[model samples]
Target chain A: MSVQSKPRVRVPATAAKGELIEIKTLISHEMESGQRKDSAGKAIPRKIINKFTAAFDGKVVFEADWQPAISVNPYQSFFYKAQKSGAFTFKWKDDDGSEYTAESKLTVT
Target chain B: MPNWFGIRTATATRRQALTAGAAGALAVLLPRMVLADEAAVADALKKLYGGKAMAEGRIKLDVPPIAENGLVVPIGVEVESPMTEADYVKAVHVFADGNPLPGVVSYRFTPDCGKAAAATRMRLAQTQNVVCVAEMSNGTLFTAKSNVKVTIGGCGG
Candidate 1:
């Protein structure tokens, strides 16, 4: 079943050239590990965001491999140096072959 | 009167002795369990870095000293780097000593990323150390660690 997923991204609106800046991201997901049993004792199928990636200016800046142990509503923050004005694309890959994406722009002075 | 079979007397004393012995064993084993978790962390590190020595600096690991819930412990890691094409952080790995799986997550970064830092939420099995190792493009490894006391277990406890 397709679920509604939302991704949030935060990036500095502006930064000095060559200055290090932080980027934070959070995504809403159930992150079910399939280990839980339903009220009727049926096993719940595992559905989690297994991979995440961040790309800037067509180059991959960061990537993460996630497991079922990641908590619900996964939050991730990372840093990148400001080289020039560009857009960062964040993508999350779910186990069910669904992908959620978000974007943030950074302007360097 | 003495019983014909010695089984009656042996059973009575043996049962009592076994109970005492079991209790004593448990008392000794409980503390060792914590140490075993540390060994697990060490083993995971060895598997990842092999014989390469990791310098313990340049990386900042932010984790709460006391986590109210183990299910969702916030973690942040950042490494000092120029982020230039010549010298940048290539990857970062996070580990939990008390979890069933020692390796929690691994992040890779390119020079275009500009900085070497990541924050995420992790599920800790119990009170344990959260360790981070950052790999630089120059083949240098930096390490940092923080202890988190988890009140409630997060790994399906």
Candidate 2:
């Protein structure tokens, strides 16, 4: 990918057991919707993140299938119940089959 | 053709049934002005439901009433559910009525997520309706729709 896209995730360090906590994630990607034309009026091929998943302790909690309409540098957020202290793995897969992964630790009280 | 003695002939009943079946399909397949404009959105919805009735509730769509710029519009969807193993939101699909393509995003949820809510940013080509549908674990579907007015184009060259 020409753009240096990086995944950023936000999670609290600690949460009460069974607490419903909101998790936020964002990645900087130059999403090409393929609807735009270049200065020469040629159609640009599509290039964007196609899938995203959030897993707690290796089990997926939430997943998203993205389309070309997603904005550039997409921002996504969801809710997760803090049951046990475990690492949350976030993955974003691109059209070129490249995957970007990030991790955050949640300490359940 | 046999002459029927009933109030309506067999051909009449058959024609009515065929018309009813084709009505929904026509609404999805018939393109207005451009190919796959808003008709694409209807097609997606029909493909997901597969002729099943979708109830109009239990889904909350949060989108701006007016978008100053169409390049970045925020959208959020939350479905009313217990989020338990027995009953939870299975998936949520979003569509834009005025985009080149109807598909915006789709999310799959599990009980471990605790809540059935997701937020994301999208690009809108113009003012249009944002459609959302949530599938429950028990195979029930719920839907909601909201409109947004955009000032500037998002996906235009």
Q: Name the runs in model 2 displaced over 4 angstroms.
A: B1-36
Candidate 2 lDDT over residue span A25-87, tens digit each: 999999998877788978889999999999999999999999998999999999999999999
What are the RMSD figures for all models against the true structure? 7.8, 15.1
Write one digit per residue (lDDT tens) for candidate 1, span B3-52: 74687888989999999999999798556333226677778778878858
DockQ values for all predictions? Answer: 0.53, 0.65
Candidate 2 lDDT by residue in tens digits, B75-106: 99999999999999999999998888899999
Model 1 vs truth, CA RMSD? 7.8
Q: Pick the candidate with the highest lDDT.
A: 2
**Interface RMSD for all numbered candidates:** 1.8, 0.6
Each prediction's whole-model lDDT (CA): 0.83, 0.91
